[model samples]
Target: MKKTIIISLLSAAMMTSCFTTGDPRDGGIFWSPSKADARIGQLNQTNNEAMHQKQKAENRNKRLKAEKVRELNTY
Candidate 1:
């Protein structure tokens, strides 16, 4: 009797879960941007932009320094 009752309860639970899956909202997790996700994305964009700008400035400075040295050596 205990086994039969336990089996029936489990079957009923499984059936409910299966039926609920038919609903669109409950079927799967949509990858909508939450506030945290948006904030994280924004932070990532800002950091990447900053790094790019820093690298460009460093390259420009290096080129300028090299040109100055070349001019001095040629004089």
Candidate 2:
């Protein structure tokens, strides 16, 4: 009976240890950030790059229009 009780206690301890606190895989109640934060950051970076590209395109268009006007006036 004593050996059985000791074995039960050891098995319980092992199981509890395996389920460890603060482990996301075990579905613990820890409040940690998820992968959404990284995804949002990546999205923001992509947005900024797109905005910069758009601005560059607009500036190029303006320069080309100004050059065309100057050439027409000279001709």
Candidate 3:
């Protein structure tokens, strides 16, 4: 009814922002390797899903590949 619609509009208006992340009070997110050694931060805080996933997958693959190559060489 009209009352329900008015309440819904007021609720939407009260909201501050749509997006939120990484609560500081909960111990700042510990991103390892720092941005210096990792050479990645812009992409880390980006709003793109595919880019983030691809970067993460690539990093894992690279580490595994390096580990395998090292093991083979040591054998």
Candidate 4:
């Protein structure tokens, strides 16, 4: 009986805590299209930047490999 009451109170507290706090930027209970679009744009920009970096690295690796092959052939 005592344990049950304690458990119930704990569960209620946990539930209330979950409800009361969080990033409001995530739209939470008040979402807008503008906010959503802004978030999407930020994500797209990040993805594009990452992809560009990756491509540059790949190109550099390819160039290095070609140089190595040419050096080996000349040796």
Worst 10-residue lDDT window, candidate 4: 18-27
Candidate 4 residue lDDT tens string, 1-75: 999999999988776655321335553554456766777788899999999999999999999999999999998
lDDT values, one for every candidate? 0.74, 0.75, 0.65, 0.78
How do these models rank on TM-score, best leading? 4, 2, 1, 3
lDDT of 1: 0.74
- Shift in Å, residue 32, candidate 2: 8.1
Error of 2 at 24 (Å): 19
Global local distance difference test of model 4: 0.78
Off by over 4 Å in 1: 1-33
Clashes of each: 0, 0, 0, 0
The residue-by-residue lDDT of candidate 2 on 1-75, one tens digit each, is: 999999999988776655323334546543335544665678799999999999999999999999999999998
Better of 1 and 4 by TM-score: 4
RMSD (Cα, Å) of candidate 4? Answer: 8.8
Q: What lDDT does candidate 4 reach at residue 25?
A: 51
Question: Tens-digit lDDT track for model 3 on 1-75?
Answer: 999999999878665434333433434334334533343455456647778899999999999999999999998
State which candidate has the highest lDDT: 4
* Candidate 3 colliding pairs, count: 0
Error of 1 at 44 (Å): 0.4
Q: Which stretches of candidate 2 lie over 4 Å from their true place?
A: 1-32
